[model samples]
Target: MSAKESGRNVVAGIGVRGWLRFIWRQLTSMSVALMLLMLLAIAAIPGSVIPQKMSNPQGYARYIEANPDRVAWMEKLQLFDVYTSVWFSAVYILLFVSLIGCILPRIRVHYRALRNPPPRAPKNLLRLPAHAQASGVTRDDEEMRRRAVGWLRRSKRYRVICDDEPGGALVVRAERGYARETGNLIFHIALVGLLVSVAIGQLYHYRGQVILVQGRGFANAQVDYDSFSAGSAFDPASMCPFRMTLDQFDAKFRVSDAQAQDFTAHVTIDDNATSSKEQIKVNHPLIIGGAKIYLQGNGYAPEVEVKDADGEVAFAGAVPFIAQDNVYTSLGTIKVPDVTSGDQIGLVGYLLPSAEQSESGAWKSVYPDLLDPVLVLTVWRGDLGLDNGIPQNVYELDTDNMTQVAKDGKVVTLVVRPGETVDLPDDLGSFTFNGVKRYVALDLRHDPSLTMVLIASIAAVIGLAMSLFIPRRRMWVRIAGAVASVGGLAKTEDENLQREVRSLAEYIAAPDKAPPVGPGQAIQEGKAE
Candidate 1:
């Protein structure tokens, strides 16, 4: 092809290589990286606002039930598993890729610049952003160049070089702020390291929760946990063998306003051969076997007893109730699938600590402390739904196949206090309330990459500070025989550059003599302007 035709084709359209270069340049631009970062942050918001099924199945289930109309869409979008959702993952992955693309080229450019010397001095020093002149100098060009080089080197802040032009003019070129670009590169590199650490942590971490009543113990086993979540790569066999026993649970409330003050769970831990006791409270976790045990919640578990119509003890134990409010109003269900001498029975009840009657004549808890506790029970008798073998929530009662126990066509409301007994309708059973014991909800978590994340975070902060404080600058001093000229240029417009040029001019020209007229007055005039 003719050279003119080739040039015409190139101008008409970009080839495949040119198109690829254009796309890459756009992706690696700082503006594109910033937009990706903002999009990633917005994508993470739903993870915090919505209840995640991986962490809290009960809460997620309640959310789904509460928003029945939106359940299908939420499930399809994986709103209940926001962190692992496809849309969130795509955004996170894109953000990391954009950052990497943006930083790699910058790193290469910075490395080359660090290896190269400061740029050559411009010929017209008078036209520079900052300039100062010293005329009628006693020393020659060689001495003036030597003194300027010596002074800059003595400052110990600049990379100094002296050179001579073809016309015998001496020049000294100095640069002091390479650290500004170095810090910028370090900050970006640390961000990449942090993202890698977080990805690794997410792949290997595990978290599980259990409710422990006072005096009860639990082993660190998958089957023992009420709910558990683990990374895709987590191995069950790698879990440390540990056991924890809840010795006591103490909760304090503000006497003035009845608000919760503090909660502490005293626990003894056995990690293989080692054993120790620790107080686990909110924000204070117990570390054992490379795992952390955090106190998440506290509530009352009422001790109850039930006897069949034949007067034989059927069920007797502590039933944990889910707390409904800060005042310790709790809801629970007790199912007696095998009564031995009577029909299967289910009891739904509410327990109130520090009970009192509201203005509307309804029962409510006045405080969180154990003062005048009351239990209101509603009895139901029929199939307990255990024969079908479907899993059911222990905290909820399935009353579809059950009939309420009533007298004179009205459902009986049995209100009994601690240490009191209430007989059931039709003499089916007898219920006894035997005070309450405290229980704690414990979250156990293990993440191997937490230390790496911390280190990267600290490095990022240091790099950011250095990048913000340091400024890139260059200075040049040129001497021709008896005349010396000083010039400076800064990457940013800064008053310090003018001051530095003025100061260097004053040093070159003897201070004992009268001040240099035009340049000194011009600097002062510029400053005033």
Candidate 2:
């Protein structure tokens, strides 16, 4: 290789190394840390605004169906799953690395500083921020120095050092408040710990929700939940071994507008080795087997019995109704896919707890309580498209291929109250409204690192308090011949240093009596020079 080519290669390597160092320094700067934190916060907005598929599959699906044109773009941006998105994870991971790089070196420097004493007394004490001079404390230099050191030691406030100057004057250097620096380091370290705790908690967490009607039971298994979501490192087999049976659900409402006041679920739990009963209410959860169960909602489920044309019972169970208003006006759908005689049937309509007729001949609900409950259903009969193996929304009925059953040249309408039976049109079937039962929604969650997160939060709070409240300062007392000079300096601009210097001079001048004047007045007069 020629010498010019070799020199060019060397210069290129040096350029690359220097560029990398610059990048590292910028990443670890406090400005970058604040920016990354703000970016992380901005990135989390989509998680709350858009429904996540892992938590609400039905709602998410409906959203996609409503915006068919945006699905591809939204998927590419990972808006549906913001917390687990690759870009979000990268941002937080980089923040964690930056904090580590910034805090570790500060901790090392602060540790070394604590082991060393304060610097020697300055040469020109008159040039300090606050200086005080006292005469006639003692005629001998040795006696004045002894009294000053004795007074500083008795106060027990500063780290004192006594040394001899070139002119045979005694110089005493004292410093305190190393804890100020230590606290600053600790605050940064705690921030790093908080980030670690949150990351670990996210990795090992799992949450699932289930809806159980009165007299229904649930097992803590993956298949038993209506919807379950797990972390990236979560193991399904590690689920808590427990079973819950809901005995009763009670909902209380206010007198006006039927606003809900409280909801409580009475449940019995079995952990295979023991059994216990607990009442779970809003904001108060039941903790068992490292998992917490919370009560989120309550609604009414209408029980019904259906029979085909042959009089054989086809369906008998309670169907949960989704509430649409504060007065418990609910919407529900019932599909009978296994009828033995004729085409399958589907029923769709609203369940009114307090049924009322409007002036325009429309039926509506008047109250949340079941004062006079009624079911107004529209009947359809045809192919339900159930055999295609595609999942269908349980709450919605697809009637694209169904024929509406009518009676006397009008569309058929079945109105049934509690314990009422009505015959279907075209001799299709018979339907009866049995009764109404209450149901409660429960969420179970577990995270192994929650304790660490709590500890880190407490540490961060304490470090923050110390870093803000503690002060860093230095003071020096020098005795030359019969005169004593004191000077003070503080890390921050405040009046405490001036006050402290004047007080020390007074204390040395009058060991058993109060000084004649205040520290502030003395400092002002001295500054006139």
Candidate 3:
């Protein structure tokens, strides 16, 4: 179709024509394209300032918590999560619409340009910026004109026109870099395509987080997780068959007089599936059953022995303890239900990986490994707050509903070194330190769409590059005759010299040449003469 009709159809189909029509038109306008390019750069600021959803969520929550009122307002404004904000989506959609609108019209115009040669070279050649004349060349005007046209076709990139009048004249034109517009459009369209691809990922992809304590073998289920959030079209079945067992954990740290470095942990995971049996570390993740299993951290596991008033060992095993300061030192609890013990009773203790007697007579860890591990006991008899419905830290000792009976003061102390047992003097009974076991904190994740998203991202990038760097250009050619004034100039070197000395080529060839060029050229050239 014709370019004019095609452009009209596009506008009509979109149902817009008014002052706002400029908005729609300008949105698709080249001006709007430049604006979108700038807008994308400006829009990226919020993602960096605020904590993105991809990063630590708790830290971002803390930021919101710090300013409840402001964050609430920001949420309303979608500023906190700008990438997923409705306003951001609107900007993206508008930019895309503008892209299509602009490209279609340009495509139509380009098609038209390709089909039509430039309007017959301007009627007045002397009126143009580039015009030159010479007189007194070959006597045959056609031959001189033909020679000039050949020169234009060879070096001037022009479809030439010549006059049959006396000394003959030629017209030449050339154009280059016209394909730059096509390149610009491709770049814009590629940007729109990339946005669409990113939106598809944002709407269709899913990711979740799960925190597993030591000795915990979590199944890939909806429950028993710290948090979970899914994409709009995410499906639970897309989750991989994730089953992780924290088989064994080992941590080693540098023990030096100065700085401590070279922190390392080794963990063994078995899933009974493909790539199941593997050893993982902090930087290395084990691929188990099509999921990534990382040993996020490691902590102490104190060997605890529990006994009742009946002199029977009710519980005896290594209880997971969280590290507090350094050197694998951890805080853990040994809870004994009041119903089972017939009284509210619990023991909270701090265990150290390597304990040393400071010069001030305080306990501290000299190293992280269990070289001479020790656990200083602080006795507490209380009702454990399990049924209180209040969340408690697994690495803390809750001293509610009870008190410390005896004050050991500076003299009170008991350090159960590794392989040693401490005996209680009262009927509270005694426990032995058998051995210790280290446990790893594994973060097991499964996202079936991760690879697909990556693939789409790569494709989008390549498409974008192809569209940006490549340009499409074209040339249009029109040819006709030169004017009489040009044709009549200087058929001989004699006339050329005579023209320089005031000759009369224009008076002779003004009637039978390429339009007014013959007249305009003669008038201009004679003045110069």
Candidate 4:
């Protein structure tokens, strides 16, 4: 045939319908489903290794800052958002569809098999894998058939059916272990449920973090959190109407090595007119109103009162300091933007919990406890960047347009202890170190699909156990004038099938006292004809 004619004939043979059928068959096959499942797992690896924007924004920012050139390419590939990426979603959707397609047909077939009866006994039973025969039985054919059928049903729990042969013989066909297929189907169905639950959770869950100083209150609102991330479908109005106050916070550290021993945050929660006091600790979360509040971290917030040159208080609140070392050496920023004196004043400083002057004349914290707390600060005068309409980090002070306070052509530093006040240079202001209060960083998470996920996980485990341990097998028993035959077949390789058949044959021969025989052994010396 000519090349063009051959191509035309091939196209005619396999049209659009044939091509679609072939694709559907391949996509719905068990092998394809398993491969897709594996591919989904592989796709999740990038989400773990790379910093995800939704889960770890700080880490993602750091990664972008460190690898500025790669950020564009990585974002284009959706590496930072692996779970929500188009490729990952496509794999997930394909796996879901494949599992459903593969399971539905198997379920239909299994259902039909459940409604149908066991197959008829074969003509030659000796050809089976496990077979046994007995001759010279004293019982009548009717009694033998009755006893065999009754024993198979009552003792072995097999679904049995008996029929009369044409030549005064009886045949009993029995089968059991339909639960194997049932469990297999249940396992696949549970997998689909788990996938759906996870998808819902990824679409509607919300998580946020907040830092609360002692004696401060916080409400459950999107605007209250310092950092918040939520699924695309999450709504701010759905948040529970709850309020919490940090009444107190406590921390303990080892004396010798300054290792942190424990941390606890005491808080009062008010939800919908109900009020309760609770203590939150690491790993132990407070669950309320379908949300869980976890104590993520703890630090110290130094209470300070900043006054302008006119002695009017400009800033009076606790400023949280990020801990820099195990000894509680912390860094903080205090911005006095509303000062009515000179230019806007900013104070950048470190808090040393247990102050100790080093050999180099630098102050550092020798211990985590408040042995000799001191604030070491540097004053600045500038615009404070408040009127620029640009959002800034509360813990960071922008010093680009600021001039450091100088004394005799050298930058001046101020050291203030608790209850002590230090004056600023150039008559900017004065700041008093009142005291220190403990603070706690809390993370609240709400996932409405958690219950469904937990239930589906448990069901999947049970179904898998059932499918693995259960055995499917069939047994047949035939009785003639004074002889009987028994045979068994296992869906899989079961070593006990021969023993069961032999036991059945022996029981038919002698109901009260059956002969003991090894597995796969015939009761009689000659094979049945």
Clashing pairs in 1: none
Estimated TM-score for each candidate: 0.85, 0.87, 0.58, 0.84
Model 3 residue 313 CA deviation in Å: 6.6
In terms of TM-score, which candidate is stronger, 1 or 3? 1
- Candidate 4 CA-lDDT value: 0.89
Model 1 Cα lDDT, one tens digit per residue, 206-319: 988899999999999888999898887889998989889999988888998888888889989887788888899899898877889898988888898988888888889889
Q: Give model 3 RMSD, 1 decimal.
A: 12.2
Question: Per-residue CA lDDT of candidate 4, range 80-107, in tens?
Answer: 9998999999999999999999999999
Model 1 error, position 239 (Å): 1.8
- The predictions' CA RMSDs to the true structure, in order, are 4.1, 4.0, 12.2, 4.4
Go through the candidates in order and give each one's C-alpha lDDT: 0.83, 0.83, 0.55, 0.89
Top candidate by lDDT: 4
TM-score of 1: 0.85
The superposed Cα distance between candidate 3 and the true structure at residue 372, in angstroms, equals 1.7
State which candidate has the highest TM-score.
2
